[model samples]
Each structure stands twice: as structure tokens, then as C-alpha cells.
Target chain A: MNGTARHRILRGCRALALAASMLGAPALACTDAPRGTGDLGLIVERAAGRLQLVETTGLTALGAIDGLGDLSHASLVYSRDARYAFVFGRDGGLTKVDLLCRRIEARVLQAGNSIGGAISQDGRLVAVANYAPGGVKVFSSDTLELLADIPAEYEPGKRAKVVGLEDATDGRFVFSLFEAGEIWVADVREPRAPRITRLRNIGAQPYDALVTPDGRWYIAGLFGEDGLALLDLWEPEKGVRRILDGYGRGQEPLPVYKMPHLEGWAIAGRHAWLPAIGRHEVLVVDADTWQEVARIPVAGQPVFVMARPDGRQVWVNFALPHNDVVQVIDTHTRALVETLHPGKAVLHLEFTPRGEAVWISARDDDKVVVYDTATLAPRATLPADKPSGIFFTSRAGRIGL
Target chain B: MPARHLELRHLVEHDCGSCHGMTLAGGLGPPLTPSALEGKPLEYIEAMILRGRPGSAMPAWDAMLSEDDARWIARYLKAGTRK
Candidate 1:
């Protein structure tokens, strides 16, 4: 708020829209001041398939929405009134964006290598978890249109690749197939006659999933073995439930370099904290006895253990020479309280929709370093470019972001 | 182009573009284009970048790359870095 105090509030909203259009009154055509995209956010410019509209209350960078095609592995969602923003990418595009009109109000491509997306439980659908001709499409979130395709064959013609796309609670969605270790659950509540619910084997190569934040537990994450499958969405006939099974049992795991993102798990109180696919740990389960209550050791392989929205600290991050560090723990002394380094390649890390501050991107130091969740310090750095995923519009009302 | 080959072309554009595809055109690792290594063999793409891909999640960068940084990231991913 400097530059002469934001140029005196944009010169007092252009002098109250030039004295209310010289006294005939017809200003604010839509908005210019008093806006409220609830402190917006976007940031995934992965090598310039752009999008950097931020605002966590002005840790500034409010606009830069390029064509957004193959964003290296982009991922987005928000619009339960967070004023639109769908994104997805990895060349399968699917855009939508309109975060207070910063552009891209609809773009499609739809599939041919994709992975990531979800926004329904009634936000009028927006699925999208594909991987070059694999499955799940369901659109129409205010007109990205294509309402439901659903292919992930998982056997017949062998399709598979659709991992952990969540959105539970009636409008259903759930996901995960990764070359068919199965875990479907569609039911888009008739978003084109949906009703699926598969679930088979549920192991090997699950490679990413998550849905608990009260949208009941979905939890995939099995990169071809050793732990984590858990479905339950309030007992779907008690089917898939492998939880921490043989966690690196005979050891020899470490060699992952970026994959752990079970929807950035890390709850804190009844304990959750996941991330250990190839060690450098952080496990600690028992979020109501899914068991295995402690592993913790972190600094590398754990790409994001998150939880700082008042669950009292967790925040991890690493993969690739410990991707320029950022540890923190202390969910009531689960240990390691503060490591930081925060730059060069750090990648994602959100929290600040009531967690006071956490941002963190850094993608090889292009910038974005906030912090200050109760004095973990460095509060504010902004300057993203190669940034990979930093979402936010307060993740539009939560539930499995 | 040595600044350590521009830091090995930024570790093959963001550490092998984190499982190839910062336009290498594949995710969960597969397309390291040059027409997908066109009939493979630049020492089998530098032995899958210094001994990796054994039953998959392709790791072994021979402990952070070498052998001329995996033969200069297999000739800058078979001469196609800006893909």
C-alpha cells in the first residue's frame, strides 16, 4: 500500500467516478474499488503457459493471464463463488479463469495428457483428470461445457491414468486409476447419467489422491505399492482400505524426486500428515485410527505435507536436492520445528485464508516467498514466473482442495 | 554455453522437467522428444540419464548427474530443449 498509498486509493476511485458521471450517476460499471474476490490467487506460470493473478491481501502481483496451454502440470479449481478459475493444463488445457475479469473466461482442449482438477459437490461440475486419452471430463462450470465423458477403462481396452481427482459429498466424483488399480466413484449426480462406483484392487501405482476435509476419506497415493488406499466416504460398503500397509517394509525406498501430493495431506489434530512415498518420512497417521502413528523425519522426498490453518504447524516441501528446503512440523511436538531455506525450486505451499501467511513457490527462485504463520518470518517476496501451483481464492470453500 | 552448461540447461529444464514434459510432451515420464528419442540410443539416452528407470519412477541421476552430466542431458534431450 505504498506508491503514495496506492495512488491515494486510485485517486479516490477516480474522484468518485468523476463526481458520479458529472451528476447523472452511472459509475462503477461493475467494479474498480470495493471488490471482493476474497483476496484472490492463481500463480502457475510453469515456464510461461501463464497465470499469476495474486492478492493474498497484496503480497501483490495482480494480473498476467497468458494463453495457458501446457502448463508443465498445472492444476486449479475454485468457483464456489470464488469468481471462477478452473485451469488444469498439461496440454489438455481446460482453462476458464475470470477471476474478477483478469481474462480467459473459457478455453477447452479437454484431453490428450492431463491430470488434476475437480470442483463439484454442486458448484455445477468441472471434473477433468485425464492423461492422454484416458478418462474423466464432466465440464459445464459456467460453460466450459462438455458435460461428462468418463473413459478410464481400467481393463477392457486398457486405459487407466486418472489419479485422485476429488469432490465428494453428493455430486460425488472421487477418482484414481493409474493403469488400473481402480477406485472410481463418479456419481456426478447425473451430470450426464454418471453413477459409477468401481473400486477394484486399489493399490499399485495409485500415485496421488486425497479428499478428506470432511468430504470423508478418499486417500489414494500408492505409487505401485506399500501403503495408502483408504476409501470410506462414509463406508462405501467398506471396500478399499489399505492404509499404511507395509510402509516401506523391507526398506530400500528413497528415489522419488517429486510425486507426493495426496492433496497435500496434513491435518494435525487427530493427526494425518502423510507424504512418505519414497522416504525422508512424515507419515504419522491415526486420523481416527487409520493407524501408523509416527515417522516424521523430513527434508527431501516429501513434496508437501501442509496443514497450517490452525491445526498448529506442519508445512513441509522437498524433492530434488530437497528442493531448497522448508520444514516446520510441531503439530504438538511431532518435532522438527523450522528449517526454511525457501527459494530455488521450492514449488507449492499455500495457507493464508486464515492461516496468516505461507505462500512459498520459488520455482528455481523466480520468487514468491511469504511466510509469517506466527513468525516463521520472511513475510513477502512476490515475483513469480516459473512458479508451480499456488492456488487460493481461499480454495473456494475447502472440502478436499 | 557453459555456466555448467547453463546449469545443465536448468537440470534439463526443471529437473528433467520433473518427469519430462515442460513440453517434452509426456508426464509421469515418457516423452523426451527428439521424436521420442527416435529409435533410441545415444548410449540408450545416456543409460536412461545415468542409470535410472528400473521398474519405473526413474531416479538414479547417478546421484545428481555426471558422465558429462549424463552426456549433456543426452544431447540436450536429443536436440530439442525448447519443445
Candidate 2:
């Protein structure tokens, strides 16, 4: 074929890809968006007493649902099956919405005061991190029924406040207790009656914990006490091995000075990329050997760290000072790749299962921004009223239940 | 006067110690003890009660309590705990 004919053939293939994505079903529309490459979406935090779904296909404003009043600190998670998206409200209510049906099917009252939650890989359970009266509630995926309310066991003379929860690949759940400086592990195989096992004295305050893909180890981000705590899940009794410390050096620890330190961590391949929020950089540690391999500078206040499914590049979200954008870094070279501005207060982010697009919750704007992965351009914005926590389902053709 | 002190005591037990220390000794913030309130004058204490200590976790009680109610809290913290 002639050179011009070959070029025409490539362009024709690209156009077909775009057209096929547009014609895909609504449930699969989210996956069609570029993932690990940075395509984003918005989950609007609607005003108190109302619910609204803003379709991001063309960034058009969708209608609203009334009666779900002023939900503060709302976190959303779509099931693995993608049949239902559970919205856990701060007021202790869990609103179950069917994305395909485009309506709330059932509302479970008082699913516990939640900051956010993680849905199981199998879509069997939704583990909610209760902020107040610290604990977690494991709810059934299909019925949205409350199965377990596992409270963090407070040590003698110590107060424990549950800050975050993340589900592990192995039928277990990890809960971070901020005040107690501990992470509690619970066996959720039974769901209803979970056995709580305390992993104590991890750090000054364990703010967040993330399990590896294989669920062999758990790494927690300590807020006040800088650095990450690596816990051996194989032996939960031994507690965490203090691997890395002084995440953002030069800043004094909390209760002294209020500069935030280590805030978020993401596991990519054999490297654990940690966002040093106070220092405005990211620290990469070899996951297997657990040693600092590289340190790369990034934009201001990198809070949330997310990676591409292929572990090629790591994305960092800068949260404050009116510059809400994501910084992409090359994992191999540990170099700055691109900086794409999404919106204000980009608190939480997630990539589609297929690694095509990235979705971010714009807290200040009450909307979700979806960006294309390849171009790193803002593709679409989903209108949400005060949307905070956002997650995408791995299921191929199902929307939220 | 004793009845008022008793009521203030009850309020301290239920409301004050919940976030602060159980004995008003301080949990999330400074204690409510005499030492914690020392150098803080009666009027200053009243303002702190109504407006709350800024930059700290202390939330303003202007919406929850009135001026007189705040004053009562000040008096209780200063004198009512004296027995």
C-alpha cells in the first residue's frame, strides 16, 4: 500500500474506535473512557435532601432527586458487578442507587457515620469507614443490608478513632485507627460476625491502609508520625515493621506544628509510591525489599496517590490552595510526565478497570471530572452536589444498582 | 446558688467532658481545669465559651448556648468547681 493509504487506514481505525465508544451502552460508557491514562469523571455532591446524576458523556446536567437532605462527607462506591453504587452519607444513611435504572432502589438508614468505604473485589461486601464513634459497617452488596458493625477495640488508656477502611484481596478488611496509632484487621469471610484482630502500635496515627494485590502485606500512611508502616498480613500478631520514616522531613510532627506529612500511598508493581503532602514530592520504595529507591518532586500538597493498572505511571492529586490537578510521573524513570488540571479540591480519584480513564471528585465545585488518559485533557464532567468518594466497577456492562 | 451549681455540674458531666477530657482535663484540646483557665479572666473565659478558641478544634457555642448561658459556664468553671 502507498504511504498515504497507510496513514488513511490508521486514521480510519482511530475514528472507528471513537465511534464505537460513543455507541456503547450507558453502563459500559464509564469503561470506554481512558483509564490509567487519565480520563476522569465527576460524582456531584448534591445539596442536602436531594440526589442528582450528571451524565458526563457530553457534560450535560441531569435532573435531581429530592428528600435525601444535606449529606455531609459523602463517599460513593460502585460494586464490582457494577449493578449498584452505594452512597454512604455522613448522616449514617446508605443510599443504594441503580445506575442503569437511574434511581435509588433502596436506602439503608444509619449504615454508620462514614468518611468513605471500599467495595470488595467480588462485590459481596461494602466496608464503610465510620468517622464518628469509630468503626466500620460491612454491608451486603446485593441487598445493601448491614451485615456487621465491627468497632475498633480501644487499648487501655488510649482512644481509637477509625479514619479509613480498605478491603484486601483475601477475604479480610483493614481499618485504620487514627488516635490509637493502630490498624484493625477483621476476617470478613462470614460478613455478619467478623472477628476483629488488632494490629497495634503501627505509628502515631495510622490514617490510611492499603493492601497489596495479593493481600500478603498491608501498608498504612501515618498522618502525624511521618512515613509508612508495613504490616505482615501473613502474621498479624507481630504488628507492623517500621520501614520508612520522616516522609516529609523539616516539618515538625503534629500537636506541635500543623503541617501535614505523609497522607496517601499507592502500590504499583514492586514499588510503593507515597505522596509526601507536606514536602510537595513523592517517595518511591521498593515493595519487595522495602527500601527507598527514588524521590521525585511534584506539585504542591500531593495528597492522593493512584497508579495505572499496568504500573507504568503513578498519578498524584494535589488537594489544596485552589490548584486541584493531577501530576503524572513515569514509574521507570521517576520523572514528571504531565500535570493536568481537573478542578477545585480534587480529594479522591479512581481509574476505570480497563485502565482507559481517570475519575476525580471535585469537592469545591460539587462535580466529578473525567479526563482522557492519552491526552491528559479534561474530557467530561459529571455533575454531583458535594461529591467526595468515587470508585469505578470492574464489571463489563453493568451500571450502579 | 447550690442548685445552680448542681445544674452546672450536671452540664459539665454530660456536655463538657464528651469531647474534652472526661474530668475536663482535656482530650482533643486543653483541659478545663483551673490551671487551664488560669490567667484567662472571667470575661475572657466567657468569650472563649461563646466564641470558642480559634485555630483549635474548639467549636463556637453561640448557636447552641446564649450569652447568659455562656456566662454561667464561666462562673461554674471559675467558682462552681471550688466546692
Evaluated against the true structure, the overall lDDT of model 1 is: 0.82
Residue-wise C-alpha lDDT for candidate 2, range B20-76, written one tens digit per residue: 433454433446777778788989888876776544435466755678878888877
What's model 2's TM-score? 0.67
What is the i-RMS of every prediction?
Answer: 6.3, 10.5
Provide the RMSD of all predictions against the true structure, rounded to 1 decimal.
Answer: 22.5, 12.8
The lDDT of each candidate is 0.82, 0.62
The residue pairs that clash in candidate 1, if any, are: A113-A132, A138-A148, A205-A224, A345-A364
Which regions of candidate 1 fall more than 4 Å away from where they truly are?
A1-7, A12-31, A36-38, A52-250, A254-267, A270-272, A277-282, A285-302, A308-387, A393-401, B1-15, B19-41, B53-76, B81-83
Error of 2 at B24 (Å): 22
Give the per-residue lDDT digits (tens) of candidate 1, residues B1-83: 76898988887777677666676777777878899888887888898777888767787778787788888778877888574
Best by lDDT: 1
TM-score, every prediction: 0.31, 0.67
lDDT of 2 by residue, A17-122 (tens): 5665688822222222222211222253533445554443344544544455335445566655454667766556777765533456677765334555777756
